[model samples]
Target: MEGKNSQLQQRKDDALPRGTGNLCQWYVDQAENATLRDVEGNSWIDFAGGIAVLNTGHRHPRIVQAITDQLAKFTHTAFQVTPYESYVALAERINKRVPIAGKAKTAFFTTGAEAVENAVKVARAATRRHGIITFGNAFHGRTFMTMAMTGKVAPYKRDFGPMPASVFHARYPNGVTGISTDDALASLHDIFTQDIAPQDVAAIVLEPVQGEGGFHIAPPDFLQRLRALADQHGILLIADEVQSGFARTGKLFAMEHFAVKPDLITMAKSLAGGMPLSAVSGRAEIMDAPGPGGLGGTYAGNPLSIAAAHAVLDVIDEEQLCERALQLGAQLTELLHSARTTYAAITDVRALGSMVAVEFADAQTATQLQQQAMQRGLLLLTCGPQGNVIRFLYPLTIPDAQFRQALDILGSLLNQPRS
Candidate 1:
């Protein structure tokens, strides 16, 4: 008598570890553009965007065709074993596009964590230092080194044995949370004075726009200060654009918004339009510090992923998704700000382009809104260290009519009395 979704849920619960959490109970039967259909025929407007991995939307035709073309030719040859033109070509394209100064070099990987880890490797190789400094509420990755670099502890680090050493945390500026730019910088200096000396630190990695910690846009002045500090200390500045890249932030890269540039940048989500591909681009000299074979994987630049990445770049340019991101984000931000008047539970609404989020007065309120929106056939995701911020990661390619419908559902939910 169980429905297909219920049956699948039961099977999943039995087969998978609880650590691999599921936000929706229903199983997806199909997905396209900005909508997902469950096995029961219910369609949900997707706002999670597969956690910012679908800036170009699900199963985009161009990306699909590119993947199909590669599938017909080859899947994997291990770039390190047998070099491929697509991998080199993709790196060249990225090298030209990255915001780093002086010729940049890019290397591909399989995931955000891999890109981040390799960035650190390159930084250490170049600077001859082993220490890494990240910030509070930063979610770099689930790997041991990244886990240590990550600032939050509850779920990401919980039950995971001791993290690799030489990683420290500093405060990230949050005006809403009362941590200012000065305070964040002070925390960094405290780490230098109290924990690791500046000369010993290889890199200071941070998200230009913190994703899971809540969509807090790093203030421009703060970034400038960090650049100055990094320069003064001979430490590399790494912008983890894993969640903020690929036109999601009204620009191809969030670093484009600031005048200061990073020595290296880590990217993954939305890089290959849902294909598992990550990359780190940085100054050529720093990237080359790692000897050959020191920075590649068996599946680093799978031909299929490379093909998809090419198509993704093409689609972003052809569709003007960067400009579209700005337009859509502006509309959503205006809506949330307008809703603030009626919803007392809405404490803050913030955004950097379409990477938007709304913080409620309490975690319960945020979760309630997410549940209510899901019930209305709209998928939403909640984040923040306290679980009080609901982030919107809707694809930039979402049709206007569908997007407007999702907004209406959210408006109605917000206008209602808090339960």
Candidate 2:
């Protein structure tokens, strides 16, 4: 059966258009903890963690059991037609847990892109404005509007032309580039003064930690000032936590580090232990601005996905994964830093919790490092505008021994002289 599947995959790739990229070998048989096995019987320690979707590790027993229990009871009810308790209970739990101060409400969706899109819809409905502001190097999604919001061009926005309008990009405060919080604010002011008026802007959408554009941590002061500015202009502040939420960043949500209260928060990736689930949670008043019938889909909150999400939350709390993330992150960061002394090519080493990264001097070097690591039975992902950053999203549930082994392998590789 495995042989047949391999042949089928090869045939599919040959027959279909190759616009979408493929990763790793052709066949993946099984995965557990922080390792994946290809059909060829090679095992590779997974550092990418499905781009931060396996914070609790691959196929966590609790999450699996939850899915099994829900599978036995009936899968889809189309929430609008027949609501389920799991969905309501999960929503209630998220409402109570998301790091907002006052009353908050949540709406579930199928993907991170959907969550982001819905957040914008809710913001526009609440503020009755037509413009949205985002940061340069931001990657929201692939949809028309999100592509317009995204700042990167080569791959994501290259062939996709005539994107939605009224979405403007601002410079994020990047200390490495000498752009300060005040500079970011000034960029916003320039946007309002030279481009779009503040009164016409509905919301300012930003990632607490920029994911695809490189692991750039947004300064706390920048987020605070954006919050204040949004309030002053009666505009919504949307925190896109799709990549940094669910304990991937020590806290339940990355915005917690800044103590900024955004009007909307979009989350996904690790929310449901690998299930296709996402959510837009925020201020009750603003979320309620959208008409009752305006916010729903056929598979918005699948019962099976909701059950898995509940178990995910339970595991996070019960296992104290957030604390574990912090410790593991520190260990990895130290290891990377120690190796950097030998590898002068490593320019930056940064992380929050287990969401860590090391940027190389250029895309060629980063790609070479990734290939070298994969050849050594470790899988790593390269992300950044220039593809120079190697980000680590190992599962929080990875065994200490396995993590240490992976770290040793990485150190050995990075310590090698540039070829």
Query: Which has the greatest lDDT?
Result: 1
Query: Candidate 1's error at 418, in angstroms?
Result: 4.8
lDDT tens string, model 1, 359-406? 998998889889999999999999999999999999999999999999
lDDT of each candidate versus the true structure: 0.94, 0.90
Query: TM-score for each prediction?
Result: 0.99, 0.97
lDDT computed for candidate 1: 0.94
Candidate 2, 183-211: lDDT as tens digits: 99999999999999999999999998999
Q: Which residue pairs clash within candidate 2?
A: none
Error of 2 at 348 (Å): 1.0
Off by over 4 Å in 2: 1-9
Best by TM-score: 1
**RMSD (Å) of each candidate, 1 decimal:** 0.9, 1.8
